[model samples]
Target: MATKPEGTQATRETEAELARFFARYEPAIMKLGQALRAKLRQRLAGLFEIVYLYERQGSLVLTYSPTERGFEGLCSLALEADGVKLHFGRGAELAKADPGKLLQGRGKTVRHVELRSVADYERPEIEALLVAALQLGNVRPEAGAKGATILKAEEQKQRAARRPTAARTTAARTTAARGAKKAKKARS
Candidate 1:
């Protein structure tokens, strides 16, 4: 039997942790997230992959940085219920880099592109944006160095509260009103 490499077990554990984190999302969304992550790992070769699992928000954020600190992340893949977003950490500062105006966000520093699939990330424009994001962040990954996945937080299984739909909101109000009327009649 061929012995596994030293880091093979750790890599498997990391993948398993990510699999658990992605279980709540739709299959398409999960696939997109994985694709994006694979692409990032390939492109940002020596950068550290910092994973943040937000159980309450029902999201998994994978950030790439030269160091382990998340704040130094050049880019991130934010996986949520609706879709996957490619976030440029210093987007606002990369004004000249985004000639196509592909980025969308009103924030001061961050901007993102909603990725429908890996093809979106492979676009020349998006590739340029990724380069710009890294340049702006001043990340210099050592040539041929392998990056490792760093799980920033332990898994928290708390489910996020879904937004109440209009019908649900109306039904809840009606139910509350009926309860209030019943209490008033009982008091009388």
Candidate 2:
């Protein structure tokens, strides 16, 4: 009889582990998504969004028309079952925005539900996020700072945007920016 190497076996085991993790959370995850659907629909009624989910890469992002308050969009909730990593920026900002309004909790995760016209999101928005959190129950979100890279990219973009356009060429004066990330990680 032949046996697989420990490394290969470990990979398979890890895959199985992730599969098991997802299986256990699927029910709760689906239920949470459904409960928030109405609120999400109401808030994101007419907008563009992109949702990506994977054992490693997971995100639910929404981009919409800027409201009077100048909020460009929301990061919403990003979760990974394997790591139980959940980010709570959308709700944190909302909470800070309006007193006695936004939900209070940083370690806990909350998804964005509605847009706020006032300087801060209304109490209802916070309540909605809290509802989502309760539905999610006590799950510790993984804490890791992945935003620094994004900030660097945005800072570079802003710096480029601020530079004066060339005088001679009309194209140079135009302010069209394209997202650029070197296709090959090693750009030699």
Every candidate's lDDT: 0.81, 0.35
Note each model's CA RMSD in angstroms.
Answer: 8.0, 18.6
TM-score of each: 0.76, 0.32
Residues 59-162 of candidate 2: C-alpha lDDT, one tens digit per residue? 22222222211133333433334222223335554454445443445444343333322212334545455444433333222233111001122333455566
Clash count (model 2, backbone only): 1
At residue 172, give the lDDT of candidate 1: 94
Candidate 2 stretches greater than 4 Å from native: 1-24, 57-72, 79-95, 101-188
Cα shift from native, residue 26, model 1 (Å): 0.5
Candidate 1 — which pairs collide?
Answer: none
Off by over 4 Å in 1: 1-6, 142-144, 155-188
Q: Write the per-residue lDDT of candidate 1 for residues 27-131, one digit (tens) a residue.
A: 999888887888888899888888888866878999898877788899899999989998888988876788888889989999998999889899999989888
* Residue 20 accuracy (lDDT) in model 2: 48
